[model samples]
Structures are given as C-alpha cells and as structure tokens.
Target: MLKKDKERNDAFLAIGNIANSVKSAIAPYLDGVLIYVREGLSVQSRKRGSVNPVFDCISRLAVAVGQTLSKYMEALLDPIFACDLTPKLTQALVDMGFYIPPVKPTIQERLLDMLSMVLCGEPFKPLGAPQPNTLNSVPIIPKDAKDP
Candidate 1:
C-alpha cells in the first residue's frame, strides 16, 4: 500500500534499507521494495525531498542486490530519470550495479585469453590468415584411369 501513497518516499527508503540489511532474508519481498521505490520517484511525487531520497535509496538497494538489480533497471530508470536525474546520482547507481563491471570492455579484453580457451578450446585464427580452401567440389583422379 506504500506504493499507493507515493508521498512517503522517506518511509519507502526506510523499508528499502531494512530490505538491504537482510537481503536474502527479504528476497521474496524485493519486488515490493522496488515497487515502493518506483512509486516514490514517480512523476506524481515530484517534491524535491521525495525524489532525492529515492535516488539514494535506489543506489543503496543496487549495492545490496548487485547484478540482480539489472533486471529491474528499466523500470527503475524510467521513474528515476523522470524525477530529478542528476549525474552524480546516476553515477552512484551505475557504480553499484546498473552497468555491471564484468560486461565492461576492459574486463572482456582482460579475460580474452581465458575465455577463448574455455569457449572455443583454441584461439581463433588471425585476421591475416588465408581463406580456407574447399575440396568437396574437386573430383579425385586415379593413376590407372584413362583419359576420355
């Protein structure tokens, strides 16, 4: 019912922080936490006080949940940016979980060697390698075969 109110953003964050503190214990109720958060940041709750707390709450929940927050990113971002999206707040959210660290280009490059071995069992050929030739279309000739 907290979502129905939309004005009690501070209260929503209070519950959110509690959820963060006992993360796994509240796993089943995580969606409700996000629901209230989204509601608090909704356009209807445009009060400066309400919006900022929601941002802080979002960042805290993100840190607590890690990549699990990624699934709700779209829902969270819409209302968040719809309110008072500042660079600092956005950065906080990204730092916590929005842009996962492993997906970064640096991480991929760092893992290229290990990933190649694990995924393909061998390194791929270089770009300069000659194009592979095919033999399926060629017919075999025997030494004893007479010419037509």
Candidate 2:
C-alpha cells in the first residue's frame, strides 16, 4: 500500500511540475489579454448578449490552460502506459462539458516530444539533418602551414 501511495504521489508531483511550468509560461500572457479585453469592453460599453465577448475570451483562456494541463499529464503518465489514466481524465472532461479543444501542435507538443524521445532513449529527428562530414570537409593543410 505504501509503495502504491508513493507511486501515485510521484506521478502527481511530476504532473504538478509540468503544470507549474506551463502556467508560469502562459500566466502573463493570459493576464495581459484579460486586462485588454476588460478595458475594451468597458470603453465600448457593449451590451451583454447571448454571446458574451468577455466570457468568451475568458473561456478560451481557460480552455487553453486546461489543454496544456492535460498534455503535461499525458506526457508524465505515458511511462506507465499500462496504467494510463489520461483517457479516463479526458473522458471525464468531456462528460463534464468542458471546452476541450482539438489537439494542435504547439511548443508544448515539441517539448513533450523531446522529453519522450529522451526518456525512451530514442534518437531525436532533427528538423533539418546536418550534412555528413567528408575528407574534403576537413582542412587539407596543417594549421601551421603558411602561404608558399
């Protein structure tokens, strides 16, 4: 039981770390957007309607945060694939009617991919592979050689 508890705690901690990193990266941007939206709404004095622009902006931000959190959780939980709980969590989110957006490749995707590659001991597929070195690539003359 203690071993199981430790494993669960470790998993939660790992997820928490990823969440914190993402939140720290995005919080400032979200805050700025919120302030901008609020000021715009106040200045325009737009009447509240079926589609609340302010709420929509807030909802978008919340969705972004939620998606980021889920991606991090998925990456952390991936090691224990057999015991994967991401699907369940995703389903729960859907059932709760949360605004779960489609998965789009972002910086988070790249980071998680790199992390997965490192953890799996797999070779990274660089965006552009470097040209192979050849004999001609090396300096033909010694560094000490001077102009004849």
lDDT of all predictions: 0.59, 0.39
Model 1 TM-score relative to the real fold: 0.53
Q: Write model 1 residue lDDT over 33-141, tens digit each, in one string.
A: 7787776666666653446666777666666666666667656654554443366455555555444453334323423444466678865455697756779656787
**lDDT accuracy of residue 10 in candidate 1:** 56
Once fitted onto the true fold, the runs of candidate 1 whose alpha carbons sit more than 4 angstroms away are: 1-7, 47-49, 98-148
Candidate 2 regions exceeding 4 Å error are: 1-25, 47-51, 66-148
Give the lDDT of residue 47 in candidate 1: 52
Lowest lDDT 10-residue stretch of candidate 2: 76-85
Best-matching candidate per lDDT: 1
